[model samples]
Structure formats: structure tokens, C-alpha cells
Target: MTTAATDTKATGATGREPWGARAGRLLRAVLSWPNAAALAVAAFVAAPLYWMAATSLKPPEEIGTHPPTAWPENATWANYRDAFTDNHFGTYLLNSVLVSVIATLLVLSLSAFAGYALARLPLRGKAPIMVSLLMISLFPTIALAAPLFLLMRDMGWLNSYQGLILVYTALNVPFAIWILRNFFQSIPKEMEEVAWVDGASPLRTVLSVILPQATPGVFTAAIFTFTACWTEFLIALTLNTADRYRTMPVGLALFGSQFTVPYGTIFAAATVSVLPIALLVLIFRRAVVSGLTAGAVKG
Candidate 1:
């Protein structure tokens, strides 16, 4: 065996790591506090999703163990079948889709025009308008609950799809406008001027030139708006008392009877509920990243 000193000298001469240093490097990497913290946070965020999926796979008998097994012993799709067939998952899913899509579209259309005006037009008191909108967005939804309900009730709009769609659109527009305005501002003015010189109208330029370049921002806003509408609980609950008009969040809440909660069924429903949101995010992940990172270089 090589002596320690000989090994060190040999490694130094050959410009190679000694076995001990290699071990130490491995140990350091494994024990790094920052890495450990990052992994811990990642696990914390991902664990519930994993648990839900795993639980959804497990049969009724295999669930509710005090010392839970990480992997299911008997994986089955029965729970999912029950969740779909026995529950009103189809209706809830349909309601959520309509609400999320319509709300997102309305926000995008209205915010695009508003953002373009704020970014490119010579409007008076724009700063105050922006600040006011920001402040309004910051207001707690709980605070507005009573007032909104009273207003909706007065207008005979409670428990209706139109009401929920309108509320989600209005609620999300301010933030969408802010995002799109920033995106519009980040784009150079030379392009728009070029469009103008080519005999394009302002509307034509907005439609054909600037909006295409601002796709990332539009995608980001859609994700945010859609996610909010998809997962909204309190407003959906408060506004819609009828079971038929209930959204997924409310539907998820009514997963069990008083006698025995169907944990497996609940998990199954939860997994299905999360799938659409996950798919949406996955499909647009690149745009979301680009949109979020766009202004960082300039700032």
C-alpha cells in the first residue's frame, strides 16, 4: 500500500485527486447545507403531490395505515373509477373548464387593449391609474365578499355561470394588465413605428405586430388567471349554493359522507382535479419561464 505522504506527492505530481480527497469531496457534496436545504424544500413541496398520487393508487384496505408504506402494495384504478362514475366529477370538470377558459379569455382580451394603451398611448394620469389598479388588486378578497355577494344578489346573478365568469375576469384583470403593460413596455418602439410607417393602423399594429411578440406575457397571464379560476373555493362556494353549478374546488370538499370519509376516492378526485392544471403548466412552461425572466435583464 502507498504511504499517505507518497500518495499526496504522487497525486500532486500527476495533477490528480488523492483517494481521500475524492472521498472528502463526495462527503462534502452529500453533506452540503445549502444543497440539503434545497432538497428539503423540494421534497416538502412535492411530497403532498406524491402522497396524493400514491394514495389514489392504493385500494381502500391498503389506505389509512398508521405506519404508511411509501409505495402501494395493491395498486388499482378502482378509486378513480368510483370518483368518476359515482361522483359528479364530469359536471364539476365541465364547470371549471368553462369558468377558467372564459375568465382567462376575457382577461387577455381586455387586458391586452388596456396594456397597449398604458404602454403605447399618451394617456393622462396613467401613473395614478396604474397605482389605483395596483391598490385595488392588493385588496383582500375576503373584505369584498359581503359587498360582492350583496351586489350579485341585488343583480339576481348568484349561483350562475355568468356571475362566476364575470367575477373571475374582473378579479384577475388588474394583475393581467400590469403584467402585459410591463411586457409591452419592454418591447422596443422602433417596431411599432415601422409598422406605422408601412401604413398599418394602430389597431392593426397592435393585433399583428406587438401582440405576437408579447405571447409570453399573455401566456403568463392566462396561466395565472386560469389557475386562480380553476382553484377558487371561497367565491365558488359562496356564490353557488346549487350542487349542479358547483366547481371542482367545491366538489372536492363534498367528497365524503358523515359516516366514513372515502380517503381513496378523495385522493382520486384530487389527482384528477390537479391533472388539467398540471398539463396546462407543462405545455406552456417555456413561455411562462420566458415571460417571468423577460424584464429581469433590463431591471
Candidate 2:
């Protein structure tokens, strides 16, 4: 086997490794330990999700069989039919959609302004403020659940779409601000100055110049916030006690009663619940990848 170093030394006066040697080296790197570890982690995270989806398609007997099969023995769509018609998963789906959309929109709008300010404004203690905001985000959500519930109750906000949307927005804003602020800082300050030189106000500069350039960052932030709200269970569960207002995550939890849980129906509902989030990620995956790569390089 021609090792990369030996192959390079064997290169002719042209001073280039042979194409085959370079390809071999690239292939080895791709299969290196770090890459192997990454693939392992991916499989670890994906296994349960795939199991849920596969189980959803399986018949009841197959789902409970000992030494379970990785793939279904027999497939059926009865659970899916029952999910929408019998379990009221449709209402839960609609509520999740409404909350996720409104929350993402609010986060985008608020984070843009907050990020611009943190990135551009000359103010005292701004660095500390940013750090403080991030620290708040790092705190556990469960810690505030009780207080938030009480506050919402006093304001008559619980058990309603607005309450959940607002809570989701507030919970996600800090991280969004952090991401957008750093992303905004990556752009050349000269661009904003030029916009101002062209007689554009700050708001106009952002809408026309900054925002257009920040597309990837915006998409990344939106995807992050939307997924957080979409999959969040504790806050959604605590804030909305009414069956009608429960989101998809809470609905999936209630798929079976205390007496018995139907794994088939539960899996079916879970599969349905994941579709929106999966769709959102698939649609904006390129943007999320680009934004994260660029942010890492710049920051």
C-alpha cells in the first residue's frame, strides 16, 4: 500500500501526488476516528426516532413481540387514521403549528433588533450584558416553570395560544439574540455605514442591507427557535391544562391512558408530530449549515 507521504515523494517532477493516492488519503481521513465517532453519535440520536417511525407502521402484535424486529413484520395505517379521527391529534397539530409559527416570527423580529443593537450600538457594559443574557439562557427552564405559570395565571394568559406563544418567544429570545448578534457582527461594519451615507435610516439600512446579507443567520435562528417550541413539552404541558390547547408533544404523551398505552397509536402520533419539524429542517438545512459554518469561522 502506498502511504500518502511515500506517494507524495514518488510524484514525478510535476510535483503533484497521483490522483489515486490523494483520493485514498481523502477516503482514509473521512473514515478516521473523529468521523467514526460523529457517525456513532448520529446513529445514537437517530435510532429512537427511526424506531418510533418503524413501530408506527407495524401491526400491534409485531410491536409487542419479544426480541423486537428492527423493521415491521406487517405494516398498517389504522393507527394513523385513528390518531386524527379518534384522538384529536389534528387539533393538537393545529395548535402546535400556530404556536411554532407565531413564536418563530416573534423571535425573528425581536432578535433582529436586539442583535443589531448588541452588534452595532456603542454602549457601556454591552459585553457583560451579552454574557448575562447567555447565562440566563443556560439556566434550567424547569426552575421558572412554576413562576411563569403563576404569572400567566394572574394575567389570564394560560390555556391559550397567546400564552404559549409568548412563553416560547421569551424562552428562545436570548439564544436567538446571541446567534444573530454574532452573525451580524460578522458582516463588515462598512456596509451599514455606506447605507447610512446613502441617506438610509438605521431601520431602512437593516431592512435593505443588513437583513438581505443575514439570510442564512435568520434561517438558522428561525429553525432553532421553531424546533425548540415545536418539541417543547414541559412548558407546553404546564401552561395549557385544557385538552383543546395542548400541543403535539403533550398530545403524544396522552396517547394512552393510565390503564393501558397503545404503542402503535403512540408511535403513529409521534411520527406525525415529527413531520413539521423534519420538514422545516429539510427545507432550510442548507442555510443552517452555511450560517453555522460561517459563524464559527467569523466568531
Candidate 3:
């Protein structure tokens, strides 16, 4: 009996050792190859943005010097001060903020209702409507440029905030609807049923139960919409030719044209341009992550 027990123990140990060894080898291989490659790619991508920030801090002479300085000898706020004072950056910033915020709010509100209807209501031609929206999203905005330009001209909305807001909202709606519809569909019907059982109306149920759960999706939608509107160049350039009405993109273009590409000032402006969106993302990162994860899991 002792001899038999000893033989069984040896066999079990041998089997366990090989399996553990194989698992370790597999883990090492994964960590060494694809994971390492991904990290390297991320670093490479981030290098230019970091360089831009660093260059923004350098003196104009240093910026233009042969063999560029990776690090500034003496950092200064001169570039940023010059950027705001010389470039009319303040006005451009305000315009961008106003247009982006209003457009995002409108898109979110409209898309919420449209998404909920598509998700829950049994409307005629729902499939076709969704397909049409998808197709419209696929069409390049450049294709609509000439017609949209003519329309804006006819409406006398050229160089106006209203025109830009209208265009931004329209462009963002299809994406907002797609995202919010997926979110609404993921929400369990049981919650709504319970609300209804408790004598809540459809609107009340949606307001009290659904909207709160959909915050992540809403945040995601708002971020994307705002970013798109804020950075849009082609439409803004064609629609708003007046200096006072120009948003950041067109303003930045004008800034570029004013000088021989003042590297420090341009970088400073670019850095400032990135701050608002970065701050927004950081503030709502948790919601964004949760929304994205939930959407992926449910889908």
C-alpha cells in the first residue's frame, strides 16, 4: 500500500509540473511579444505631443536653432502670453466654447428622445430609418460641402454662430443616436416594468429610471460631439469667413498665416486648445469608461 501511494504521488507531481511550466511559458510569451509591442507603439505616438509641449516652452531662438533642443535651458511663459495677446486667442476660445457646448447639449437632448423611441417604440419603418441614418453617417462631410455652403448662403447664416451650431448638431445626430440607442437597448426592461407597476407613466419611468442609468452613454456622446464641433475646420472655414465669428480651427489657420509659422506661439496655442477637452475627459473618465465597457459587454 505504501509503495502504490508513492507511485501515484510521483505521477501527479510530474503532470502538475509540466502544466505549470506550460502556463508560465505562455504568459511570458504574451507579455514579451504583443504586450511589449503595444507599449512601444503608445510611447512612439505620445512622443510628438510631448515634443510639441516642450517646444512651446522654449525661446523662439532655441526653437529655430539647428539640432533642436529636446529640453529648454530656461522655460518661460512668454510664448503663452504672446499667443493670447497677439493672436486674438481669447475671442476664438470663447466662440469655440459657446458653439461646442450648445451643439453638444442639443445633440444629447434630441438623440436621447430619438434613441429611446427607436429602442422601445414599435414605429413603422424603424429598420429603414436606422439604415438611412447609418448610410448618412458613412457619407463624407466633404461631399456635402458645396450644397451646404449654398444653403447657408441662401439662409443668410454665413459667418454666424447659428449656422455653425445647426451644422454641428446635424452632423453629430446620427452618431449620438447610434450610441444612445445601444445604451437604451442594454437597459433591462424589468426596471421599466417595475416603474409602470408602481403607477408611473412612461415619461416618468424614463425620466426617473432610465436617464440616470444612461449617464455614461450621455457623457460619451457629449465628449465626442463637442470634440468634433470644436475641431471642425472645413465647414467652419467655408461658413464663417468673418474674423469675429471664426472658431479655433479657422482662427488657428489665420494665426499660421500671419507669420512664418512661429513655432513657439503655435505650440502654445495648440497646448491651450487641448486643455479644455483634456480636462473634460479627465473629469468624466469614470463615466466614459463605464459607459464604454457596458456598451461593449451588452453588445
Candidate 4:
């Protein structure tokens, strides 16, 4: 009887599991679904980019061969070398960098001021102004292309960096204003008031107190504006006539015309073109997320 009772107690102890251990297992299982889904999505998105890179590295003969190769049979740097030497991609890259940086800076500066005023100042007709800006943004840019062309022609600004910058800034401002305005509104007014009480002027208050807090939103606006200008095709195509003046999009398109459709070189150029934006996102991912969330919440 004593031996049987001892065996029953041991069985009961073995059958019972601690609550903490069971809870941990359940939590891990629940989290695994989302983690697995996220990884799958990432893999799906990365596949095309990987393919582009692989094709770019492959030799010309292998590119159009039957039964596409997953990995390059003979990987070479010839495509990249040709992309620079044969296509003048170096010039195109410079133009793109200059145009994108300048345009982004101008848009951010102007938008910040406009957004700040709209959010904080008590100006008359502000509602109408905001409404008009929103309405303008909704209109298709294609509709204004003809008029813009004419205007640029009249001003002798066609094919000019200044002209491109102006158009980019104009096209981007409304959206920037809307974004920054919300971000500005999200900032507590009490902070500005405190700065004012400490003998800081309005401009100083904005520069010192507000701008720092709003860095995420500013970065978000700048990056978006830069990417848009960098990748702009229609306006760049229409305005720029000279190959030398052409931005990346125009230059890349012209690559087909210039050569026998150098797919390898084209892919190489494309990879280079996308690298900057990708790097920016990777570096400032936190700011981008915060900016997006803040803007959405405030809106």
C-alpha cells in the first residue's frame, strides 16, 4: 500500500505543469505566426531585386538564354564597367543627385514655413487656403503638363535644372504642407509658450524648441520629396531636351535608344539609382516610422 501511494504522488507531480512555462509556450506560438508571415513577405519583395542584381552580373550571352539561370554562370563586372564607360551613367548620376538634393531642400524649407504658419498662426482665410491646397493636390499632374511646358518655354527655363527644381517644389509643396502641418499641430503648444516666456522670439522658439521635436516629420517629408523628384519621369522627359541635362529616369530611358537595349547595363544603373533611397530608409527607419505614425495620428 505504501509503495502504491508513493507511485501515485509521483505521477500527479509529473502530470502537472507550471503556469509560467505553459504561458511562455503559448505566447511564443502566438507570436510565431506574425513573424513567419513578415519573413515570407520580405522574401517575396526581395526576390525581384535579387533577380535584377543577378541578371546585371551575368554575361550578355547568358542573359537571353533558354531556361533562365538562377545564379550567373559566369559573373562579371563588365556590365557595371560598361554602364559607366559606354552609357555615361556617371553624368546622369551627378545630375540626379544635384537635382534631387536641391529640390528636396527647397521643398522642405518652404513647406516647413508654410506648414508652421498654417498650423500655428491665426491668419484670415486660412481654411480656404488649406482647402485650396488640398484640392490642387488632388488634381492630376498630367493635366498641368501642357501648361507647365508652355510656361517653362516662355520663361526660357526648359531643360534647365532651375526649371526642374521649381516644378518639383511646386508639385510637392501641397502634400508637404499637409504633412508638416499635422506634425506641427501634434507638438504641444505649452513648449512654445515656455520658450516665449524665457525671452525666445517666435522664430527662435520654432528653431530651438519645435524643430528638434519635429525632426522625424521633417525627415519623412524630405525623403518623400527627394524620392519623388529623383524618380520623376514625365516632367523630366518633357522638359529636358539635351542628354547631358537629363536626370536618371530620362537618361535610363534613353539608354535603350542609345544602345541595343543593354539590359545588363540598365539593371546596373537601376540598382545604383535605387541604392541611395534604400540607404536613407535603412538609416532613418525609426524617423520614417515615427513621422508616418505622427502625421496619421494628427490627421
Give TM per candidate. Answer: 0.86, 0.86, 0.85, 0.88
Residue 187 miss distance in model 2 (angstroms): 0.3
Lowest lDDT sum, 10 consecutive residues, model 4, at 9-18
Q: What is the lDDT of residue 84 in candidate 2?
A: 91
Write down the lDDT of every candidate, Cα atoms only.
0.90, 0.90, 0.87, 0.89
Model 3 Cα lDDT, one tens digit per residue, 209-275: 9989899998988898999998999999889989899998788777756457777988889888988
The residue-level lDDT of candidate 4 at 288 comes to 90
- Candidate 2: lDDT of 39? 85
Q: lDDT by residue for model 2 over 193-285, one digit each (tens)?
A: 899999999899999999899999999999999989999999999999999999999988888788988889888998988888789888889
Task: Candidate 3: list runs displaced more than 4 Å.
Answer: 1-35, 297-299
Candidate 3: residue pairs that collide: none
Ten-residue region with minimum lDDT total, candidate 3? 10-19
Residue-pair clashes per candidate: 0, 0, 0, 0
Writing each residue's lDDT as its tens digit, candidate 1 over 154-178 gives 9999989999999989999998888
Regions more than 4 Å wrong, model 2: 1-40
Worst 10 residues of 2 by lDDT: 4-13
